[model samples]
Target: MDFYLVFTIFIFAGALIGSGLSFYVEYTKLEALESYFSENKVVCDNKRFWGRNTHIDRFYRMLLISQLLAMPKTHIKRGDVTEAELAAIPLSLKRWALWPINFGFIWFASIIIWNVWYR
Candidate 1:
């Protein structure tokens, strides 16, 4: 049961990190989209390649997911994260802006309780 609890925490943390990484990747996409929109301004064309994924990008994205999934459990728990109390540091860096720690809390608790109590 304790193993399940720990495993739940591990999976939840992996999910949180995965989500944060994906969100950051998507933010980069949004920045590119904004740049394109600003430069083109609805220029009339027939090539509608919206939301299309390039081969290399998809490959790397899959690689990232696989790499994260394969990462050792100890590394994440011991990973060095930036949680400094400085005036110049941005809130996004000082805090887990993309996927905060509470996600791990709720995710693990829900999974553990559901499995232990209901299963």
Candidate 2:
């Protein structure tokens, strides 16, 4: 019974994290949209969400920041992306939109395996 309880707890926590990530991705997309308008000077900065620093901003920025930090430091190339440009690809462009899907599967599989086999 206790093992089942623990398994359920883990699954619930994982699901919560996954849902939060989904929200973060949406927030990132909104921020990206804000940037696009800002570039054209069509939307004032005040109209953007929390001045583009919403609480969900960190992880979304992580994707861009990490990619920039991973690039080479040398040899100038005309088409090569600069650190700032690389750090601004917009989360809406990433294929990781389905990241939380894995969490749901893992949660279900954990419950099934633990309850049916371990318990």
Question: Which candidate comes out best when scored by TM-score?
Answer: 2
Overall local distance difference test of candidate 1 = 0.42
Worst 10 residues of 2 by lDDT: 40-49
Candidate 1 lDDT over residue span 1-119, tens digit each = 68667776677677767667655644444333223223222211211333345644433433332232234253245441111212233444323322333455566677777677647
Q: For candidate 1, what is the TM-score?
A: 0.29
In model 1, the clashing pairs are none
Report, for every candidate in turn, its global Cα lDDT versus the true structure. 0.42, 0.50
lDDT of 2 at 10: 78
Error of 2 at 43 (Å): 24
Q: Single out the weakest 10-residue window by summed lDDT for candidate 1.
A: 39-48
Summed backbone clashes in each candidate are 0, 0
